[model samples]
Target: MRNLFPQRVLILFITVNTIFSLSGCVSHSKDNNDLLCVEKNVLNTANAEGSDALVLKNFEARPANGLLKEISVDLPAYESVVYFSTDHRDKILDAANRIFPWAAKDLQTIISKGFKPDPKAAEPSRNGLYVLFKLPNNEFLLLQGIASPDAMSHFTINDNGSLKIKLVTFGTETVSGDIPLVAYAKSDNLYDVFENAWKNAINTEALAGRTAMRHEKEYPEMFTYLGWCSWEQYRRKITSDLMVDAMQKIEESPLPVRWVLVDDGHQHQTGFKMGDSRMLSFDAHPETFPNGFKPLMDLRSEKIKWMGIWHAMNGQWQGLHPDHELRELDPHLIKIDKKFRGEPLPVMMPKGDSISSWMFYKGLIGSTKKHGFDFVKIDNQNRQMRFYKGKENPVKTVSQHAQSLERAAHELSGGLINCFCSDLLSLMNTKYSAVSRVSVDYLLNNMEKAKSHLFQSYQNTLWMGQAVWPDHDMFHSSDKFAGRMMAVSKAMSGAPIYLSDAPDHFLEELVTPLCYSDGKLLRPLAPAVPLPESAMISALTTPEAYRVVAPLPNGAAAFVAYNLAHPTPQQIVKTQISTQDYQHAGSFIQPAVPKWKVPEEGLVYYDWYDGKGGLLNDQYKIELDGFSDCFVQLSPVKKGWSVVGCIDKYLAAAAIDAIEYNQSELKLTMIEPGTLVVYNKKPVKCAMASKVEELGGGLWKIYFPKGKEKVDVTVTL
Candidate 1:
């Protein structure tokens, strides 16, 4: 592989998700011993760092403050001895690539290094490294990564202008759980933009990078501030009858129950239920489901779509249920690497127990068709990171996971698999469960908490075959507000949502959806239009409209005007009623009336709606004793998307229409500077709600209004 920048080594990565990258370096004036690594898409400076010797050193001090300090690499698989530094993160990477084009699968830099020229490129196999080749003329073409680590990195970027770079492996959690330090440029205002950059880095490093070797993953995005509960709570009360009952509920839940996570109870041999004694059976714990497995039967009838069995694959930490036949059966199965921290012990990838054991697990799958058991949840596990005994390839653990499911899939066409994890990353798609939890905990209130939970859920959902559906670990919110928040989450996301509450904590209304049904599910109307009115406006207006129309008090003006056309695109037209048309502004109504002067600046502080659930706000300066008729031109935010409603009978009836944008009258569209909404296009289909229902309690149900159907309403602008 030819060196694009022989002297440049340091590359930048977006974050924990994105992989480490390398790039050409730019020379900055060297100042003191304080050093920082910086590189970009283009090569601005050059140097000669001979590649004869290999340097390996780790920094004991924290990274330089206020400067870019990177510590990771982006290549999928390559030879490595880990060390991190601020000054050399960039230069060292460049030097390494020059000497080791075949070093990191050429992934550290999206350039195919060491490939044969011309006709040789046509050969079937590659080194399993991908690069986006943009020719000298700026022509772009997609190229895949090498197939294997042994393959040469042969690719090119002949373009002079098109910019490309690799990932950085900074800010990652080390095998020892230490967060490797990262330093950015002096102007590092690390927030959302910075966070996104890092996520992209590790993702490419781990996923796109070519290598069968797997690495542990991090999911700070989805799991931040999440709500989590210990399985012990349920274990405390597990009874054979209750276990059976819990399974039955699984049968009746809606939406496939995304994840019927089995918590800790099973391992304790904690047979609070009669099923306890049957632990040795390694078969269906029939006592747990006394009614002949009614729960599984119900799911088979379509209540729980995805079913699973939970296990503590690794944490054999507890000295309980010791089975002597374990090590004798398969030495590789029970023994763990000694290098692992703490008391050395084996960790289960697929499972450590007989129930989780390959043979036992395989048999259980076949026997449970009458009471669906399509998933498996293994908890208390981590990736193989430490130097340990009984060590195995990171791929092997995934291999076992795959073998576990592959055995099951042979019997069933498709299977639903998930696990209990705080970031179940590093597992291969084919080898790992279909879904896994990402957070160590879960919570509420902080808006980002809710939004990100869904975001994490969506990210995993988008995986083509659902390799990993993120688990926003479920919990029951005792508060109704929290419940509403959950509904909002369920409605506004793409993840397979689940909840874990003592069924009693859930309100009947909320649980109604998860209740047993005839398998026919009801889907709801989606893509709800955002209201045109501002939240501030919605708080001030009467029940006349979902939107609010208020006047900004301006002198000599009867009232200020406002329109709530925020959610969609529409041209709003209104027939105005003037002062001569209607007079006598309401005044002196209060027991203690206060005089409101015609202020030069039409802003008067009126205390209203305080007792009611509304915020009173309006600033207008005007004289109300006048007469005239006016109309508001309601239309889409875009000049091309707005239209005036056709005033069909002139003054007889009002109407709304989709054809609202006016091309020529862009000037009049904004009555004042900053008047036009710079945010969402305020389009709304306004008419009236014809029917409403009030339950015996305080709940009110409102339905959309239907105007003249099939008839077009021309909006008069």
Candidate 2:
């Protein structure tokens, strides 16, 4: 494609999935014919095209005489349709890359009068329909969009000046909906410009309780649960027997799980067939669940709050399910030219009735509900935006399909949806699923990737978290190097906790306490906040630290820090640790000894690792290794006396789990048949049912039978 303004050719380039690591050059070109370039890295690189690829011209632009009900346009993957008139083109460019709600910056604040990079440079001129900012390394940042009161354009801009935008409309368009234009900015690093845009957005949209309102409405439970998914372990090979066995094992463990996830295997289409679309028919795989999903449904208990299954957005790889019941309802729903899995599947038409789309979704989601599934992890959801063309109806954009499916999931299944691979713009404000995967899939044990993942999770928390709880995907239970690192990151993410390890690989000692234990969810005091860049050492030197400062439901405030650093990258290889080794790995790493100035008033900082801490000093330091963490749960210091440490014999529970206290009483919950220790400052009176021993001036030993629910301890000042 050739650019309409300068007539430059557009070329498409594909880079890594999440990170951009390419060898390219930034040439300073004065000639308009020359294209300056920098390496572009993006998560969805497959669909991205470079400036050399194609030039898009004005498609159409018209004003609706009346309020349009809704406008839905379907385009190819990564392709977007924008409607614009000659006058509105500049207005759209000024609003490029503004993420809704959180980051909306006005053009007046963004631009200055007669702004030019260099005094000697050519006077700023708009020869074409829009202006482009020349960037560093001879690149340009293009900012352009479609703007009508109801017709808003959503955009995703890359650090390399590559931008993707989709025009959203509430009503039919009277103008041509195809004004493809690129806006520009001059910069050394386009990524930095994007960050500035986000900051500017925050300044404009920082309304008190806005985030809180979202949390309460979209994620009331703040869903923290011990979940098991079938992806990492079983893949498409999961069976009824295997899940049943896993459920039995989960029940037997001291850890409590509220949801059991049936990841990616139960669907019926593309069976055992490589080179076929990974999409599956919504029906359960006959061989895997011969008797239907009733067997799995029967396994739910009070602790097992929901059983979730995975399915694609439009059935299989953006095609309709051949076996879907709605196929007979409307022949117009199916695109005759598309044989997704050897059959023409239905597509959500733009001009179709809401009832038709609702009924279509009802059939798919209803099928799972019939089999006793309560939650649905909607995968390949990005396909909902893929351009759709029906045989008899107008083209439907993914935006319309997304809204239709969301409503259907809400109406049919009570809005219990976990959106994966879906656009953030669609989910936000619509109050989509409580849980959403924000970052790309992380490595099982690669600490480097884990670091990047942690940074991205925190980034998502800061920017997109208000939309939904950001999920960091799954972490294995046996990855000694980075498993716990990822787990801590997940907990800090305020998202759900799910393990993909097999039944035998369940590392109770390490994994159970992260999400839940004894029916109590162990969430961070607040969402994990990334430390400022100044406070952080490079990933090459030390693990990055994220601070979670929140007062527990109990009286104590939590000052916890998680380390997401590891030694190597290849550690993410598929490997499993033996049950015996997992139970004993804690023996090798000594408890962290931390020193730091406490944050709260009248409170003393006590390290929870091995339970040894004291009064806050000027500096706080800890002996931490890679993938390890230290928490300083702030306790009130009455008469200079405080409980500094606690430990569980089996390592099944966290140090915080060793002591549960209110104003006057402390209850120690036991997870294993072993001894417990409470390192405290003052004397403590124990109940008759417990055995207490004085180890030293401040350490107290409290012994309780294995699996005991609670043991009381009274403190004497």
Candidate 3:
């Protein structure tokens, strides 16, 4: 191994053997006269070249105390560590933010300088390592380990390279305050390293012209919605009544909703197999999709701008599956390695040449695309790396997983690609998919297990093989669903908003505006509630720096705010004017309403009370007592107003105002239990309205009377 330092470094294990509090002193030592702390809890040790000196520890116990997925390293800080857990990216790289400022600064400077272990100089470690620098201050930067996406703590560096993490309080609920803990030196360039690994996700050929639901400015930011729908879910929700109702709903979709992916249903269940696409059939389950894609498929695909399905490549199964029978013919691909609960972890090897891989994927793509899909979510390994032989060729590893999609995209000549449970862009280091899950899969429960979603969204993917997104998977509301949803997306900056809502049925009034797009996520003006709504919330990004804005209806003021490093839910909704943007956009007023306008403000809003199906007639007559906003897509409303709107509750509806609408842009406001309304600042005279269920569409004239007007409108349905 190459020695990266000039001399043998200090190798001390003084795990703060400081029994008694030391008398603060500034005495000179007969040795290296470096700055020294007077406390015995503080012991200085020189770093070395090859020792696993870096260790992860908690202030008190093992809460945020697991292995870290990634970390930075400092030469001579500690010998490289011995980590056996590669399947879960589970290792820690410690850093001395307080004591080793020089090292931190060095790591940043080196990485920023584009330093990396010369490929030729890379020494083989069962665990991959590089003299890599993803940021400036290289020579010793990022040295991350994997800790599965669902891990509780993805990263944790010591505050100082101290071996003891100091803690002043200890209790049952949580150990409060700082506790000195053992840590090794890491570089600040660490994050940029992984960021470079998966940045550039947006510029892919697949999601080129698409946009998130929030950025589509025709409606309220709250009307935006995104979800991950399995092909099975898609088949179930899309029906005749559902379709017609859906068309009406689409007209008032919250955000510009361009992408609605179909997860794990279009392809075969198990892989690591022979190369024919037989097992990986790209068609929907014939049982669920009886009529096939005839009218339902062709017509729906046209109305929605971006749509795709999923494929699981690195999955495992016993001989139970018919496909597993094929694997049984060659069970050698299946083996047990890593011990989980002392039980062997199952693994498998892919059996094929590049052509077979290509052909199989091509078939899958051809099949799915035939059903009217322009986007595809290619799933990855659901097991450990042991399944793929855990080799050093990450390029090969990523290729085995994403190659099919990339090749398929090439064949399709530019289509959206989505990846899950995979190192999506690490293979190409170029913009690949339209959206990608940066953290592990998001479980619906609110769990602050990971960091933050915004951190993952703004990752330095500019150069990494990604330009699409850091998808903060579908949002599930606890009591405060809409509020939490907005926070996560707003935090992601420009990452695409991916959701798992069952389409073809009820539409969700997601509460964040899709504001600006940078190929990643939509930028929002302000986000509302970001705290875990319930035990089911999982934060998957770093809580970086942010500015919070608690928005309320006109005149009614509010001041609820927070200071997270990164804002996730989203920011406040503001103007839609950009330096270079769509020409037809501006403060112009329209005289009439079309069949639909995604998230048209002041329009009628309608939905099943709890996102459930059935008539909402049970909620008692329109109790216009409290200002309530209704949610509906398309409906007739009074004209002659400037900005029209629809909301879920009147209280929410009362929150609407033309804070910044052009006076001549037209005004219309409709509120109460998801009702739609129309707006007209200028006179159009002509009006058209079609009624769908409780949702009524027809033109009525309402001259904006300097004050508010209350009227109970009738629904044709």
Candidate 4:
């Protein structure tokens, strides 16, 4: 075995003792002013490395805690941690995140300098569980737990300001063995350390691009889809008539909505209320949909193109009604719930016997398809990981069972499952789930809730977008107060823009941000995200930054900024436009709507709401009204051309849509009537356009009529 430090390292003092009778031995010592500890019998077997000085803490079990062992290590000043949890409740190796609160500068520096670990240096524990800490001094501290059949792990800070890693039992099992916990030190970065641990456990690199591509291949259609859901407006009171009315409204509107999702209220029973509560029969509620979900499904397919419905992952209230079709189809499908009192719980057995796992999922998903549903929103899935008990070998582990269930859902549903209210860890196993909710619900009642949605939308997209398309929930234009902010943020975030409003009250302004003039869905070039500072501050305190920006394929940058202070009565938020406001942008240009034109030297900024803008320098500032937000488009200015109107320079340069421009005569198309600005060095005569006026300073202003798809301007110099 390799010594953690060189033999020249001198030891100061050593203490050794045995705490638990069945557990292994524990020893602590000071060598070269470093704290060290050795734990024996962490696993069923002994450590191959007999002695290592750098091992900080090794524990079989703490007698004071009764089979629970804990260890704390100090973090270098200003250095944060990245904590990886095993599963939400029962899944394994599924979710990961950079933990603790991180400042903007720190996060930016670390994420920019990616780390690569040496594959051969990995040393994972038996169950392949380990924790890696990146220190400020450019070193890594690794904690490897004794491998067990299955375990759940997390980290917290102790009172003494030290990071602690804890492992506890989950699910219905309390089985325990030699609980081994070992620690190691390395002069490497956290990313490398994580890669080493992952290589040791699963023998693979945690390549971001590769993982993203895998999910993309698994869920092709969900990556970019336009849909409308019922939760934001109707909540749990959704009915067939409401759904049909919403579909009819969408069909009439210019919005390119494709999916009609039924959230929460369609089922016979949902939630945890038991006894008289109906079982999750996977059947529509008779009162709400007397004709069942088929009528709505048919209407959606004919009018909207696709259909989807929602259900709790554990069925109704973590138990199946004894009279449910699943139980009738297979006797062993639902195990009797002896874990509870009063009513005998009929727990869903998603894994185990062939009839319980395969046949149950097959019949359940097959019924939904036969009912005309094409997609499903699986919600409250974390409960499945926490409560499920397996009955067979090979699938004994929670991760195995979860994977099996997810696969069954994918295969039966034809790979169109949207996961909601699921823990981050279990989501990893849902390679088949097309869309995943990254944060909590998008509550639109107050400014605080609006801020939360904007904050989480950016943070979650940054951390989890690579794994799956982050679902930002639904937005509302008819909410009266928070509608504008909701519309702007959702449209810019590159997330699915689903609106839930009364059919007659649908606001056209809300749809402007989501679609182009021609009514095609406006897909963002990339997922919008906030800066590092925003994420760090949001974790500990109220996040002041509420912005999501993405680059367009037309070299224009689209951004949505929310003045969270807007909800306060009489509050005017003054925000400055700095160079950092759009570091990767060329010039701001609206992707969906035509806006103000920028001058030659300074850029022009246009607000989506009023289509207003003027020339501004780097230090310009703007004020916003209470509870309102703005969407802006930045288009890069070409070398020798100055634009005057709301013409899309990128589109004009590429002749996209109806925009076309050439050398002498600049020919363009306008979806909306707007003034155009043209800058030339010499005096030019303009003709053929609707109206032409000189704005002096070699800038010419031209006007085009609305609905004019073709316009020609002859320029003579």
The number of the candidate with the highest lDDT is 4
Clashes of 1: 105
Candidate 3 lDDT (Cα, whole model)? 0.30
Q: Would you estimate the TM-scores of all the predictions?
A: 0.39, 0.61, 0.42, 0.67
Model 1 CA RMSD to the hidden true structure, in angstroms: 20.7
Worst 10 residues of 1 by lDDT: 607-616
| lDDT by residue (tens digit), candidate 2, 409-435 | 666664354444423324432434566
Local accuracy of candidate 3 as per-residue lDDT tens digits, 1-717: 112222121222212222222234222233544322334433233322222222212222322222212223223343222111112121212110000001122222222233221111111112222223222233233332221111111222233422222211111122211221122223332222223222111112221232221122222121133333433334324433444344335435543344455444333333333221224234444543455544344445333555555555433221113334333224223332343357543433443345544554565567667777665555443222323322332223334435555557546633443443323222232233444444334334322312233222222222111233334445433213233433333333233454443333333334322221111222322222111111011112222222111122332111111222112335322111111111111101111112122122232222223221111121212111111112211122232232223323212323243333333333323322133333332333312223222222222222222213433333211
For candidate 3, report its TM-score: 0.42
lDDT of 1 by residue, 1-717 (tens): 112121211222222221223333323333222122334333211111111111111211111221112221222222211111101112211111011111111233222333311110121122112222222232222222111111111122222212222211212221111122211111111111111222222233222331121112211111111111224236434444665566566444332333354444533332243212112223333454344434434543333344444443332222112342233323334333332236443332233332444653354345444345544444433322221212322322332433454456345423433343222123233342343554323353333233233223322221111233344455454433245435323322212344556544444444333212221111111111111221111111112122112111111111112221212114342322233211111111111112224322211121111101111123211121111112221211244222211211110001221233354322212111110111112222212333333321111222333232333221111
Q: Write model 4 residue lDDT over 383-498, tens digit each, in one string.
A: 45444433222212444434555666676674444454334344445545545676556665655656545555565554345445566778777766677666656655555667
Alpha carbon RMSD to native, model 3: 18.3
TM-score: the better of candidates 2 and 4: 4
The numbered model that scores best in TM-score is 4
Worst 10 residues of 4 by lDDT: 116-125
